[model samples]
Each structure stands twice: as C-alpha cells, then as structure tokens.
Target: MTTIVFLHAHPDDESTQTSGAMARASAEGDRVVVVYATNGDHGDAPEDLADGETVVHRRRVEAEASAQATGTQQIVWLGYADSGMSGWDQNDAEDALHGADVDVVAKQLAAVLDEEDADVLVGYDWHGNYGHPDHVKVHHVAHRAAELAARRPRLLESTMNRTRMAADRQARLDRGEKVDWDPSAPMDDGNPLGSTEEEISWEVDVSPYLEQRRAAVRAHESQGDTAWMRSMPDEEFATMFGAEYYIEPGRTEPIEKGWPFRPPD
Candidate 1:
C-alpha cells in the first residue's frame, strides 16, 4: 500500500485543507498519516473546557477525532507550541512553531518519513496558502524534511486555486449571495490567498469524500474559525470544497486531474 503523509501547520488545518484527500486515500486502501507541527495552543478555548484542561489538550483530542472521521491511519505531533498569527509576540517564543529551527524540525519530520516509508509527503505552498507564520515555517520545514528523508518521498504542496476562488466569489455575488472570502484580498503576508490556477500542478477531485471532510472539520468544534463550515449547507460545501489543489515543485507539465499515487495520463 502507498503511504501518504500530510504535514500540517496546526491541529485543525488538516481538516479544512486536506481531509477530503485523506479520506479518499484511506478509502482506497492506502495508509494515510497526518502530522501536526504544533499543538494549536493559540486556538480559542471553548466555554465547556474541563476544569484544568488546557486548549492544547482539548485540541489534541479534537484532532484525534478529526483523524478518525477522515479514516487516517495514524497521527503524529511535532510537539511545538502554536505560534500566534503574524506579528504576534508569541511568534518569537522559543517553543513556538514559527520560531523552531527549521533544520531541527525537518530532521524530526524526516525521521517519520523514514519510519513510514512515505511515498508522498504533502505540505503547504511556499506562501503557506495565506502567509500565516506557522504555515510559512511548515513550507520550509516540509521541503527540508523531504531532502533529509532517506526515501526521498515525492513532495506535494497543498494550496488553493486563487483564480477559481476569485471566479467563484464573483459568481456568488452575481447570485445575490454575500461573499466574505476574497481570493485577491491581502492576507497575513500581504499577498493574496492561494496561487493562480495556472500555477497549480494538480486538481484532485474528492467530491465523494465531502461528507467525511465535513465530519473532520466538525470534529474541531472548539475552533471558532471552522464554525461556519460546520453550519454550511451540503451542496454549498460540496461546491466550495469538492476538490483539493496541489503544486508539485519543479513540475513543468500542464495541470491535470490527478492524485499523488496515480501515474499521469
């Protein structure tokens, strides 16, 4: 069985960004593993947090539930603190993911790749999809880890299709629906969200796994950021998240519908 590892910036990130693909991989009998770079300590705490229970503990539990919902075979944590968004003072904390030594973290990740004999290593784009500090670090660490991995796994960068997102936003507006997410709007790093469609290498259709993706996202109930997704209509969610995009670094071929384990047509 092909082993695929998805390296994410935080606990809930995999749910939104890669859960559909994870579900699809697992359903097809491949081993799917998710690695979180941080404990997501910076996430908002829910009102129902147990006495003496920290957000970190709660998030860890939630992440496990998310993995279960996505049918992931295993979960790994790099054991770093969550660095708050860009420019936050916590970003400089010694234990924060954003401040961790890239080489050190990469080595830790490389060990996992070696142990898993990972055939595919999925990470974020160079801009971290939206330029969050921890995410940007993930981009660096993932590349370095791939280089250090004994198996030299094929690396794929998960990202959004900005061109398509922008088009969808306009289409929503035309339909008299209010759109809150604008692909062209500047994000944490002052760059727009996602790469253009022309910059993408593959579009993996995961429409059949949408329900699993939704369940995964719903698992992270403590995170307010994903609340909207939990309440979104099935059809709308399918329209917005039915496909996952990736950029295969140094790939010069035209973009096509493909999965990491499949050969190009």
Candidate 2:
C-alpha cells in the first residue's frame, strides 16, 4: 500500500486545497496522513471564548472534525504557531514559525516522514496556495524533509493551472459574484507557480470524494466562506472544481494520461 503524507499549514488548508485527493486516496486503501504545521490557535475564537485555553481547545476540535471528514488516518501537528500572511506585523513576531530556524522545522517534518515511511509527500506550491507565511513554510519544510528522508518519497506540489484557474475565476465574476482575483493578492496567480499545465504530472480524479471534500470544508466553518460554498449547487461546484492538480518531482516526462499514484509494473 502506498503511504501518502500531506503537509498543510493550518487546519482548513487541507480541506480547501486537497481534501478530495486525500479522501480518494484513502478510499483506494492508501495509508494517508495529514500533517498540520500549526494548531491554528489564531484561526478563530468563539464569541464566548473566555480565555486563550478555550480558543485553543475549540480549534483542536475543529481540526479533528476536519481530519475525520477527509478520511485521514492520523493528524500530526508540528506544534508551531501560525505565522499569518506576508507583511502582517505578526509575521515577524518572535513566537511565529516564520522566525524559527528552517532546519528545525525541516527536521520535524523529516521525523514525521520517517516514522510514517511515506511513499508520497505532498505540499502546496511556492505560492503557498495564497502566499500565507505558514503555508510557504510548510511547503519549504516538506520539500527539505523529503530530500533528507532515507527513502525519499515522491514529492508532489499542489498548483492551479493558469488557463483553467482563470476560466474558473471569470465564471465566478460573470455571475456577478464577489471574487478574490487580485494578481498581487500574495498568491492568487493566474498561472501555476514555476510550472505549466504540461508540467503537471498528476491529476487525481476526485469526483467520488467530492462530498467528503465539501464536508471537510464545512468542518472548518471558522475559516472558509461556508455560506458562499453552500449557496452553490453541488453538481455545479463539483463539475467546476473536481480534481486536484500536482507536479511530481523526479518524473522526467509529464503525465500524458492515467493516475500517477498507481505502482509501476
């Protein structure tokens, strides 16, 4: 069985970006693990949260629910604090992971990969799925960890195809919907970071896991625009964004067809 590890920056990152793929892989009997770089303590606070303790506890529950919805067997926390987004004053805060040693973070990830004996390691593109500092840190550490693993797993980075992403954004705009399409919005690029569509080595057909994906997304009510997602018809949402795209490392040639997760003959 292929052991896959998905390294994410926060609680909802997995669900919003790659839960479909994670669910589909788990359904196929792969041992899939979700590793969150932070506890997401800064994500949200209950209107009645009396103290920091309550907020932390609530976030953990939310993460657990989200993990369960994605069919993840285990959730590993790197025990770091959220670094927030770029240019934010907190990005430079002493307690933030952004200020932590790169080697230290990479070592923590390497330990996880070793313990799991992962055959596949996945993370966000350099843009960090929106240029969130924690997201970028996770991507960096995941790659470094994969490189240091005794038995290096295949590394896959998630990304959006330029043409398809643009079309999708336009579709939303044409509907008179408020869309976040600013080019300079940290990581909202019209194209894949450092790659083209032809360079994408894997496209997981996640149609079967769409509901699970939605459920995972809903589990993170504190983060995503759940109401906006709920407003859309299931079929329409799934049809427009059903599959997760990836760029596989060490693959000399681009994937012409077929799932890349299948074992070699």
Candidate 3:
C-alpha cells in the first residue's frame, strides 16, 4: 500500500486544496495521513463559540469531519499557533509561529513522516495556496523534513495551472458573475518554485471524488459559501477546478505528459 502524507498549514487547508485527492487515494486503499502544522486559532470562530473562546477546539472538530469526509486514516497536529497573513497587523506578534525556527519545525515533521513510513509527501507550493505565511512555513518545513529523512518520500508541491485558471476565470466572467480575477498575480504564474507547467510531475483524476471534495470544503465553515458552491452543476465544478495539482521536488523527470496516478501498468 502506498502511504501518502499531506502537510497542511491549518485545519481547513487540507480540505480546501486536496481533499478530493485524499478521498481518491483512500478509496484506492492507499494509507493517507493529514498533518496540520497549526491549530488555526486565528481563523473565524463558529457562531456558537463564545466571543472570547479560542478556535482550537472548534477547528479540531471541523478537521475531524473533514478527515472523515476524505477517508483519511490519521490526523496529526504539530500544535503550532496560526501565523496570520504576512501583512496583517498581528503578523509581527511575539506569539506568532511565523518566525518559528525552520530546523525545529522540520524535526517535528520528520518524526511524523518517519512514524508513518510515508511514500509520498504533499504540501503547498511556496505560495501557500494563497500566500498565507503559515502555509508558506508549512511548505518550507515539509521540504526541510523531506531532506533530513534517511528514506525521503517523493515530495509533491500543490499548485494551480495558470492557463487553466485563466480560462476558468474568464468563463466565470462571461457568465456575468462577479469575479475577483488578477491576471498578473505572481502566485498565479503556475510555478510554485518559479518553474513552469512543463515541470509538473503528477496529476490525479479526482473528478470521481468531487462530491467528497465539496463536503470537505463545507467542513471549513469559517470560510467559503457551501450553499453557493453546491449550486454549481457537478460537471461544471469538476471541469473548472481541479482538487489539486502537484510538482515533484528535485525531479528533472520529463513531465509525465499525462496524469501520473493512473493504475499501474
């Protein structure tokens, strides 16, 4: 069985970005584990949570539902505090994990990888799925831990394809829908490492897992409109957005030129 470990910045990051892939992998009998680097305490609290109540407990419950939706076998938390976005007023707060030591983070993650005997390691590209500081830190630590492992698992960085994103954004705009489109965004350039689409090493057919993906997305009640997302036709959702895209680290392998996770020959 292929054991895949996903390193995420917070509770909902896994569901938002890669839950479909996780569901697909789990359905295929792969051992899929999710590692969240932070408790997401900085995120919005549920309506039922008291104003002064921390998000830690609620986020864990949300994460558990998400894990169940994705058929994840294990959910691990590194217990770090969420470091809000880079430019946010609290970005420089003394308690933030933003400036946490890279080596220390790497060591903690390495222990999890070793314990799981993971064959593949997945995390956000340097852009952190939308340039969140915590997301970037998770990516950094994932790479560093992979480097320190005696038996390094294949490293995969999740990203968006610029071309696909452009086409999709335009399609939405053509529908007269309000679209927050930024064409020249540095992160939208399709390369997490400043590389090219030709550098992508893998694609998984997560179309079958779309429902589970949407469910996982809804699990992040703090973000996204579940009802709005559900209103879209199933085919439209699958075609316009991929659950995730990945690039292999240290791989000079010619892009497979096709999805990489098709059943083995």
Model 3: per-residue lDDT, tens digit, 179-216? Answer: 87554365422423222456566555677788898788
Looking at model 2, report the run of 10 residues with the lowest lDDT sum: 183-192
User: What ranking emerges by lDDT with the best candidate at the front?
Assistant: 1, 3, 2
* lDDT (10s digit) by residue, model 1, range 1-265: 8899999999999999999999999999999999999999989999999889999999999999999999998999999998988999999998998888999999999999999989999999999999999999999999999999997888899999999989988988999999887889999999999899899999999999998999999999999988999999988899889999999999988788978653222
| Candidates 1 and 2 compared by lDDT, better number | 1
lDDT of 2 by residue, 33-139 (tens): 99888877677665755555665577777778977887789988888888776777877877688777878888888888899888888887776756677877777
The segments of candidate 1 whose C-alpha lies over 4 angstroms from its true place after superposition are: 262-265
RMSD of 1: 1.5
Among residues 3 or more apart in sequence or in different chains, the pairs in candidate 2 whose N, CA or C atoms overlap within 3 Å are: none
lDDT for model 2 = 0.74
User: How accurate locally is residue 197 in candidate 2, as Cα lDDT from 0 to 100?
Assistant: 66
Question: For this target, which candidate reaches the highest lDDT against the unseen true structure?
Answer: 1
When 2 and 3 are scored with lDDT, the better candidate is 3
Candidate 2 residue spans exceeding 4 A from truth: 48-53, 171-196, 224-227, 250-257, 262-265
Summed over model 1, clashes come to 0
